[model samples]
Target: MEKQLIISVGREFGSGGHVIAEDLAGRFNLPLYDYNLLEHIAEEKDVAHEGLKKYDEKPKSKLFSRTVRGHSNSIQEHVAQMQFDYLRQMANEGKSFVVVGRCAEYILKGNPGLVTIFILGDKDCKVKRVMEKYGLSEREAQQMCKKEDWERKYYHNYFCPGQWGDSRNYDLSVNSSRLGLEKTADMLERFIRTKMQL
Candidate 1:
C-alpha cells in the first residue's frame, strides 16, 4: 500500500499557481482541486457555487461579520470547514491530488505524506502576468495582487491560525519569478519524487 501524495499549494495571486497545479496533475495523473472544489462542495451542501467562489480563499471582513463570529463559527466558517473535511475525505480514499489555497496545508498539516509548498513571485512579474491575463494596467494589476495577497493572509490567519507565506509553515517555498513556470514545475516534480523516494 503506497502512501498517496497530497500536495497543498499556497500561492500569491497571478503567480501562476493554478497553472502549475494543472500541469502537475496532468503529468502525474492526479486530480487538481482549485475553484472546481467550490462546485463540488456546493453540490454537496446545497449552497450556490457562486457563494463559495465569492468567499473562496478569502477572509471575512466587516462585510462578513455576520458570517464569522469569534465565539463560534458561522455559516461561512462552517462551509469552509466542510470544504476541508471533503478534502481530507478525498485524500483518505487514496486519491492523489493538488489542492489550491483554502488553507489546505493547515487542514492536512499532520499527514506525513503531505507536501506543502508556497508559491510566490516578484511583484513586477506578478503584475505583468496579471496585466496580460486580465488586460489591466500595471498599477491596477499591482493593486489587485496586493489586495488578494492580504486576503489570503487574513483567511489563513483566521482559519489555519498560522502565518501566511512563512517558509517554516511549508515543506518547500518556490519563487516562480526566478524559476519561471516550466522550470518551477520541473524542479517541484523532481523534488516531490525525491521526497517520496519514488
Candidate 2:
C-alpha cells in the first residue's frame, strides 16, 4: 500500500499556524490533529487531560545522569517519546492528517510521503496580528510574542536539536503575514498537490 501524505507544521507564535492547519484540512478534506493530539494522548496514556498540557509544546528542564547504567528517562521524556510514537503509528495507519507544532516535523522527518512546513512572519506583523486578535496593546502583544518565541525555541532546541523556524528543515515554508491565511492555505493545497502528484 502507498503511504499517506502527512503535512507536519512548525510555526512561530501569532503566525496563524493553527488557522492555516485548519484551513488546509478543510481544503483537502483531511483530518487535523492540533490541540486534539493532547486529548488523544491524555486518554490513551491514562494521563489527566490537564496534566498533559504541562508537557504540550513544553520541554523538560531537569538534569539527568549522563553515564548512569540502566538509566531511565524523566517523566516528561518518557511521555514525549510515547506521544511521538503514537503519532507515527497513527499516521502509518492511513490517517492523512495535518499536525500542528509539538516538534511534529522532526518526529516525522524522512518518513515516506511526509511534507514538513514551517510558517513564519515578520516580528512586527506577528505583533500587530496578536494585538488585533487578542485586543492587546502593541507593547503587550510584542512582549507576548517575545516570550512565546523564547518558549518555542527552547522547546524545539531541547527536543529536536535544531533552530526552530529554519526553512531548511521544511519541504516548504510560507509567510502568512503577506499572503494571509486563506491564500496561504490555497498555496499550500496547490503546493502539496504538485509535490505529491495528486
Candidate 3:
C-alpha cells in the first residue's frame, strides 16, 4: 500500500505557491484544502462566512479590537482553533492531501508522513506576476505585494508565534523564482513522491 502523505505549503505573496499546490494535487490525485477550508469551518461552526473570510490569513486589526473583546473568545481565536482541529482530524484519518497556508506546518507538527514546504520568489518576479494576475501597474503590484506579505507574516507570527517563512520551520524551501512555476511544481511533486517512496 502507498504511504499516506500530507503536504503543507507556506508561501509568500504572488509566489505561485497556490499554482504549485494545485499542480501537485492534480499530479498526485490528492485532495486540496485552501480557502475551502475556511468555508468548511464556517459551516461547521455556524459562524458567519464573511467573518471567516475577513480574518482568513489576516492578522487582527485595531478596528476589530472592541468587537473581539465583546465575546468570551474572539472569532479569530475560534476560527483558528477550528482550523487546527479540522486539520488534525484529517491527518488522524490517514488522508493524503495538500493544504495551502493557514499555518498547516505548525499545526501538523509531528504528524507521520507530513512534508512541509515554503515557497518564495524574487521581488521582481513576484511583482511581475502580481501585476499580470491582478491587472495592476508595476507600482501598484509592488505595494500590494508588500502589504499582503507583511500581513501574512504578521498573521503567521500571531497564530504560530514564530518567524514566518523561516527556512528552519519547513522541511523544504523552494525558490519559485529560480525554477519558475512549472519547474517548481514539478520539483516539489518529485520531492514529495520520493519522500513518500511512491
Across 67-97, the per-residue lDDT of candidate 3 in tens digits comes to: 5345524556566677889999988988889
What's the TM-score of every candidate structure?
0.90, 0.88, 0.90
lDDT for position 75 in model 2 = 59
lDDT for residue 142 in candidate 1, whole number 0-100: 90
Candidate that beats the other on TM-score, 1 or 2, i.e. the better one: 1
Q: In candidate 1, what are the lDDT values of residues 1-198, reduced to their tens digit? A: 266888888899989987888888877788889878989877887877876576676576555556325453455566677788999898777777889988888898877778999899988899999999999999999999999898888888888767999899898999998989998999999998899876
| lDDT value for model 1 | 0.84
Off by over 4 Å in 2: 1-3, 63-75
**Which model scores highest in lDDT?**
3
Residue range with the least summed lDDT across 10 consecutive positions in model 2: 64-73
Against the reference, the lDDT scores of all candidates come to: 0.84, 0.80, 0.86
Candidate 2 per-residue lDDT, tens place, 19-52, comes to 8988887777778887677778778868777766
